[model samples]
Structures are given as C-alpha cells and as structure tokens.
Target chain A: MADSRAPDPTRRSERSRRAIYAAALALVTEVGYARTTVEAIAARAGVGKQTIYRWWPSKGAVLLEAFLDLADQAARAADGGAGLHGIPDTGDLAADLRLVLRATVDEMNDPAFDLPSRALAAEGIVDAELGAEFARKLLEPQLQLYVKRLRAGQEAGDVRRDIDVRVALELLVGPLAHRWLMRTLPLTHAYADAVADLALYGLAPRP
Target chain B: MADSRAPDPTRRSERSRRAIYAAALALVTEVGYARTTVEAIAARAGVGKQTIYRWWPSKGAVLLEAFLDLADQAARAADGGAGLHGIPDTGDLAADLRLVLRATVDEMNDPAFDLPSRALAAEGIVDAELGAEFARKLLEPQLQLYVKRLRAGQEAGDVRRDIDVRVALELLVGPLAHRWLMRTLPLTHAYADAVADLALYGLAPRP
Candidate 1:
C-alpha cells in the first residue's frame, strides 16, 4: 500500500520495492538462504531480474536489506514509531532493559521475523563472510543500542562504572539469543526479568 | 588403527565406525549439511551404503552421532580420559567454572570441532526437528552438568539459594555459546574467566 501523502510519481517505485522486499523475505524463509536466488526473488515479486540487479549486487545483499526492512517494520508495529533503534530509558535501568527484552521476546516469536531470520542466521553460522556481514549490518547495531543504554545506566549510577558496558551487554543479550537460537526453552517476559535481575545482582549470595 | 586391546572380533566394526565418523564430519564441513549425503559419506569412508544404513537411520542421525563421538574424543583428549559427563567440583565455584569454560573455549577453537559443529549448528537453526534433537541429545545433557555443579554451590553456600539453577546455568553457557556461534569476538580463556567472575559477582558496586 502506498502512503497517501506521497507524490503519485514515486508510488509505483515504492510499491515495487515493497513487493521485492516481501518476495525476498518469503523466498528465503521457504527455501533458505543458500537456495534462494535473485532470479527467484524477481519472479516471486513479479519484477524483472534486472530490476533487482539494479539495486543489490547479490542475493545476500538483497536478503540483508529485506531483513533490515522487516525489522524496521516490526519495530514500528510494536511501538508506534519508536522502532528497533531506541530502547526506552525511563530512568529505571532494570525496568528499561526488561521492557526492551520483552519486546525482543515478542519479536523472536513472530513467524514473519522468526522464519526468515532463522534462515539467514543458519547461513551466517557456517558461511563466515556472510555471517560477518549480517553481524555488522543487522546484529551489532542492535546490540550497540544496549551498550548505549548500559552506558546511560552507568551515568545514572544504576550499573557499575568499572564494568565494560560492551561485555555486560552480552550478559544481557547472550542468554536470550542462546535460548532463542537453540529453542532450549520458552522465552518469556518472566525470563527477561530474571535475566535483568541476575545481571544486576550476582548469582552468588549477597554478603 | 585398531585398538591394541584384544576383543578381536569387533575390531573391524570399530574401525568402520571411526572411518564413518571421520568421513561424515569431513563431508559436512566441506560441502555443508544439505549437500552431504549418506552415499557420499559411505563412499568417502570406503564403506558400503548398506553398512551406513545398518548403523544409522539417516544422514542427520549419522552426523549427530559423529558429532557426539567427536565430542567424546575431545573430552577424553582434554582431561586424560575424563569425558563429557561432569564438570570438576573443586569446592571453589568460580575456579571450577572458569576451568570448565576454558576447556570449552579450547574445544570451540579446534578445527575438527569448529567446522562440522558449525555446519550442524547452522542446520539446527533452520531445521526445527534436527535442532530439538541436538539440544536434547548433545546440548541439554552438557548444560545439566552446570546445573549439577551449581546445585553443589548452593549447598556449599557459594551460590544464592533462591536462583533457578536451570536459568542460572544459561548465565554460564549462553554468552560463550552466543559468541562462539556468532563469531562476534575471539572466544578465549580470558573471556571465559570474565564471564565466570561476572556471573559470581553482580554488576552492581560491591558493598
């Protein structure tokens, strides 16, 4: 659907881009990253292969952009304009982390995000070059948001100043990613809260 | 090479088993899970297709068992015949945990373990049934070792009694796994020690 406010001239291009993105995501999810071809994506999107070639250099680039676009859409849908880039810093660090993590839990569960992401991530695991590219473009930027939030927490004296925000953010993110990737257990808001609590307070007994 | 010990009747079977394991691991690493076939593993191992079918049900089963056997070999090699079932309980929780995580770091770095495991892990990400089976047979069992160790920590008053050991173990295993799978950073002994320390001590300022 074209945005009503947009000039009529650009709407056709906008529609084509959306169709390509949808097609790329669906093809990758259905057939997986290794098998999904640019030609197939073009066919599925009802566009010429040249149109896709006009934009992206390879299938990997198309899928990466498609995923980023999907994430942006999911983020907007979840929080009404406050998308994936920002974690709400409501002064309560634990509360803020938990809130974002819960949203992540929801996002991870959504089939639209889950299937295509799993396909891409599976490829990334064995294909080092592709994995690194996806990590740079898709993963690290999101993880950096946590780093920013944790740094803010340090300024607010909520998190320890001596701790590395980068590493500490792993403690926050790593467990969730592990569970989600492995399907070891159900990820829930309660799980997010507990992780936040454990991270703030060590697993060892308080003195 | 056959084992020096007699029990002569089964030596041929043992050799074939080892050959199949090696071939399966090598083929998966070279070509990936999808392209790797039972026929290929059999041919590479210099065995008949019937021989493979006689032992394992499918290519997935063969690869799973091969990985398990490889892990067993790695474990035995690491600790002078001590295998995968237990984590050392030195009565010092942090020290013991660090030691185990360090061994894990070493294992993750091994080419023999790294490539095939990555192939399997990548497949697991997209294939739900395969993923669940690996988690049950290979992963969850290993995680339970940490659960056992943490319970001992609780009894010794080293760990907080209120924590869920299952979830707590994720705090131990998750970061290592996430880092290992994502290749986000170097998985070193120092990183393992830091994760251990952070888990034991809360990120908040010490009183």
Candidate 2:
C-alpha cells in the first residue's frame, strides 16, 4: 500500500516560485541592486541555487519578474482582489482617470511597493539593457492601460478625438512619476486631480 | 618685491573647484555611488583628501555640487557663455518654452551630462537623505526658473490666473523627464512642442 500524503508537483513548483520572488524583492530592497546575488536570493528563499538558475537566467530576470508579480498584487488589491484587467470604463473619463491615479499614489506610498520598486527603477536608470527590458515587460504594459482607457474615452466622446492618446497618457502619468522619483513634492490625491483637470481642460483661460 | 609668477589664491581655488567637480562626476560614473570615495575623487583631481573634506562633508555633497556645476556649464554653453540665469520671458509663452525644452533635449542626449547625472540620480532614488538634498540644491533651483517663467505668463494673461504655477510647470518638465529617464520614448523637439501645446491649449475640444 502507498502513502496518500504526497504533494502535487504543480503546487510545489508555484510555492517555490512565490518564495523566490519574495526573496528577490526583499533582498534587492535591503542590499540594493548591485549587491543582490542569485545565491543570496536562493538562500533566502529556501531553495537550492540550481533551482533559481533553472527558472531564471540572471538576477535582473528574477527581479523583473518579482516586480511584475508585486505590481499585480498591488493592482489586484486596489481593485478589491477582482484583478485589474483594464482601466474601468465608467464613461466619465475624469472620474476614471482620477480613480486610477489615486490608486497609483497609494501604491507609490506603500513601503512594501515603494522601496523595492525604487531599487529596480534606480538600477534601470544606469543599466540600459535591464531598463529597456523592464520598460517593455513592466512599464509599457502599465502605460498601455492608460492608453486603452484614453482610447475608450475618445470613442465615447469623453476625450478629444484629435488627441494623440499615447502622448496624452504621458501628461497623466509623467508628473506623478517625476515627483515621486525626484521627491520634489508630496504625491497626493489633490495633485492627481489637478493633473487630470489640467490635462483635460488645460491651463489657458476660456473666452 | 612679491613674486609676480606666484599663483593668485582666487584663481588657484577656482581651478581646484572645477577639477574636483570633474573628478567627482567621472568617478561616480565609473565606479557608482557606493564605491566612489573621497580619496578617489581627491586623487583624480590631484588635490589632497583634506582639500575635498575641507569643502564637502561626504561624497554626496561633492556629487551634488558637481552636478550643479555641470548644469551651469551646459546652460552657459547653450547661451554662448552668457550664463543662463532664468528661462526667457518672451511674450509668446509657447515659443519661449519650446526654445528652452529643445535645449534641454540636447543636454539630455549629451553623454557628459547624461552619465554622471544618471549615477547621482540613481543613488538619490534609493537614498532618501541624499535625494532630498539634491532636490533642494540642484533640481528645485532648475524648476524655480520654470516657476518664474510661468508666473510671468500668468501676469501676462497667457496662462490662466487660477492655475497653480508650480503644478503648471510640471506639465512642461515632467513628460520630458519621464521619457528621458525611463527611455519610454524618443525625447524630441517635436515631442516637447506637443507637450507645450497640450498643456497650454487643453486636450479637450473648445465649444
């Protein structure tokens, strides 16, 4: 007779994957990108070094995946664990943009998200190859959400038809990112509202 | 009689200051923030370690001053050595902004400014105290120039009186910075022109 308590291989693999991601994010935040090593990550994750090597080719790969995972978690949490599939199409472009931006402000302030993301972003500034990869894999996808929402707004006549959605989305996202990274000023809901208003209506006085 | 060949103290001090700035920038780019040291900067500048410490408390201080100096050099060069004291206050706000932003695009593309500034900015992202210091010393001063220009625009009724000049300035500066730092898109003169138009005229259609 065989024992009935054997764990499933798929479940075991997933557990290991989550552990590795946690370890990667934590280690990078604590020691920074330059000093974080695969061996160290493996040790912290309670996995053998070969297991990490088998799954990821380099530390950058591990860190990028970890960040993607963290972002998903943050997004899901913001959307009440329903999963943030896309920007909500409430038909009110201003309200939708403001909602998403406020969520972003909260995420930026969360220490769990803030510290590690800053580490990855900081490394990305100096590391061109890694930066491009993260931009493609992580940053672009996030920006695309705004693009999708803006395009939807244009279709619904909430946004101007002639607006280049891509560049227009930058007006929504860029100021917040600049202020957060540079720490120039507080990133607040009020600030987000101001950006949305300015982007939508503009700064020129109406006749 | 006093020896006429002896170096003037003022001239010697200015020469040493420039040399130290060059040395600090180069070392940070080569070895990164954590590894770049006072001793190394002193050695590269051909000054005693005491000379560096006499002026700066740490590598952070030295690097901040170096960046401010580099920015001054770039600005002076852009203005044909006249020294850039502030943004030009031409009656046409859009035209004046376009001129300054184009110059900024050129500066961002230049390697001498790009590499060292990235090094310092990368460090600031992870190091809070240093980030705040640099923001106060270097970034804020640069931003204040935009603030002054915007205020001028407001007075001239080019910008809406109700708009916050500080926030309005971000719409001008933020997108360029976001594109340049994240490498999300090509930072071009045309792009800057679009941002200025979008910011000034609003993204929505006029009635």
For each candidate, give the TM-score of chain B: 0.93, 0.93
- lDDT by candidate, in order shown: 0.87, 0.87
- Model 1's CAPRI class is medium
- Measured with C-alpha atoms, the lDDT of residue A48 in candidate 1 is 99
Per residue, candidate 1 scores C-alpha lDDT tens digits across A1-207 of 766685674777789889999999999889888889999999999999999999899888888889989888877776667888689989988788788877788788889888998988888899888888888888888888988988888898888898887887778888999999998999898998888888878899988
Residue A200 CA error for candidate 1 (Å)? 1.8
lDDT of 1 at A160: 86
Q: Tens-digit lDDT track for model 2 on B1-207?
A: 887787789989899999999999999999888789999999999999999999999887888888888998887766566455888886999898887887787778888988988888898899998888889989999999988998888889988999888998888888888988898888888888888888887767766
Lowest summed lDDT window (length 10), candidate 2 chain A = A76-85
Count residue pairs with overlapping backbones in model 1.
1
Which prediction has the highest TM-score against the true structure? Answer: 2
What TM-score applies to chain A of candidate 2? 0.93
Error of 2 at A124 (Å): 0.6
Task: List candidate 2 stretches off by more than 4 Å.
Answer: A1-6, B1-6, B79-82
